[model samples]
Target: MSKRVHIPEYEQESELMAGEELVGGPAFWFLHLCWWQEDLRALVERFGADPADVDALSDRLTDDDAPWPVFRVPFGGGHTAVVALRNFPDDSGIDYFVHHPEWGRLGHLGQMDGHDTGPGLSWKELTAIAADVPDGAEGLTDPAERFLTLLPMLGDIDTPHDAAAVVARALTQCGIPPEHAPHIAGKILDNSFWELPSWVVRDGSPVPVCGASASPRAIPLAQGITAGQARDLAEALSGERKA
Candidate 1:
């Protein structure tokens, strides 16, 4: 009998790669962890699948042809949709795509642009944030959500806890000495988020912006604000709060 596939141990050396090729990477291990923590039957039901098919879908996780673990969402007119993670061409991030036999690939605009479409920074800023992400830190399951969480940090416009999370993630991803990571993260967090440089671009054609209904996670629009101006604003707003 074939051995059952199981979630692998988290390693400090793993890196991002195609989900299908994630075999032993951090993202792959994290995905397994998500599955473990989540209700499989509920997930299958949410995917519009019969609960009995859970085993079959789980089995497909290891199938090469299957690539990403996916589920079929039935649409009107006899069409079935497939939602899966696919590697972006630039290798900056992973994104989900909905595929239909006739309609082709349907992807989020932010996924295509490499940013969170929901009131977030652009791909460039996201990449800069990812650079700080160490190899083995936790909490990143949905790539889009992960990227979204960091958007506020780009503008230095977040609470201390949020700021610390970003710094800690970076420290962890870089494999900083575990003992030192928390200390460094705390120190960095002590700095005001408003003081950080504007890592996000403001001059790109059709610049990304937070809509009126944007989430709290979205960074406030850059509005051509310079780093020094942002620092000044941060100070003005906080009256020497230290961060």
Candidate 2:
């Protein structure tokens, strides 16, 4: 008698993994964890995928490791669409993920540029903040599964508690250290919406900004603001109390 394969169920679909290759379809974007690139790609390539712009996201992830910056990707066989930059696992040199939510139907944006980075700098506070973050293992939905899918980016929340369940669950899944789980969860919440640095150039060349409309169009439309100015603006928005 042949043994039955065991597959876990998720909110997305009741069906077990259609084998390993078809996992994380709708769950990659709002996923909360920091997954290094090399680990990600190896799993994807093992399943037979050719992704363009794989190195693209790798560059973006290495930088700041903010939320996710977006770039166009042609996956499997389709036109290039935007997906979270540099965060995916790319085994070969191909881009496997795209922004065609309709394909699997998940809402995701491709950048985290303008995250109101500089809030009052107190050495103690910075240290406190820096101390957060769990190990990578606890964030994966399937820890035992070697090829973890960093999918379905987690959404925004009004308070830390709202997102805590999701964060805690992810931490548990990935098996991150308990002491640092809250810290990692906090960063995940902070970076959930992705605020990119405006005025980025295509192919790494600067471009003029006509106006800002959040991404692609958000390259400093009005007079450029200094770092301090940007900080003030963020403070004002965050009400200083929360941020």
Candidate 3:
């Protein structure tokens, strides 16, 4: 839901230069992510996306607004949405899918390599395209967080391994010690939102850029991972034992 999500062109450029809040006429172009069935619901929910912003995106979706110009994406849940300058790539958007059930709704499904789309497009094609349009998305950012939100959308994943990985990543982003991570992978089902795929569509696929941001923020997985998982990753990566 690129432009469908509602990010202004000018603000899009500014965000890339510096990942700061939108400071323009109305809204900015960027992906809005929701987990599980909470996609659209999260928009107006108490802690959901700002009302002003939702109002802006809603306006665009309901009646084509300027800058946004058009928003033709369809949402299946209340948990995920992407606001940007243009619509998400062809066959690239999603509301719900198989794989994980507890992670929530995965907005970007076809974009992940070797997963989401079910290899409909060759891995070579995905890899090549992703390399050129690494972000596939023109104005999306925070791929890491987006990825965390998509963990529930993944297919062919080993619950233990994937869950452990997600828990570990969430711990780092949340600024918690890796040693304290619970290290549990929520669970997955074709209709489940947990264990989602990457939300940031890289060349129309899900990918994560953990630690890529100067100021890292926790991914939605923070909602699932326990302290034990994180500490495990920390120990494995740093070989440091905290007393």
Span of 10 residues, lowest total lDDT, candidate 3:
209-218
lDDT of 3 at 31: 24
Among the numbered candidates, top TM-score falls to 3
What TM-score would you give candidate 3 relative to the actual structure?
0.28
The ten-residue window of minimal lDDT in model 2 covers 7-16
**Candidate-wise lDDT, in order:** 0.33, 0.29, 0.28
Q: Pick the candidate with the highest lDDT.
A: 1
Positional deviation of residue 133's Cα in model 2 after best superposition, in angstroms? 28
Where does the lowest 10-residue lDDT sum fall in candidate 1?
4-13
State the lDDT of candidate 3 residue by residue for 1-243, as single tens digits.
222332231222112121223312112211232221333233223222355775665444323223233212111111122322222333222222211122332222232312223211112212222122122333213433433333333332323344455545543453334443332122222233323222222332122212212111112122233345433322221223233
> How big is the positional error of residue 26 in model 1, measured in Å on the Cα after superposition?
7.2
Residue 2 miss distance in model 2 (angstroms): 25
Q: Which stretches of candidate 3 lie over 4 Å from their true place?
A: 1-32, 35-48, 61-141, 146-153, 159-243
Candidate 3, 128: how far from true, in Å? 14
TM-score of each: 0.24, 0.27, 0.28
Best-to-worst ranking by TM-score = 3, 2, 1
Segments in model 1 whose C-alpha atoms lie over 4 Å from true places: 1-93, 96-109, 112-156, 159-162, 169-176, 179-209, 212-243
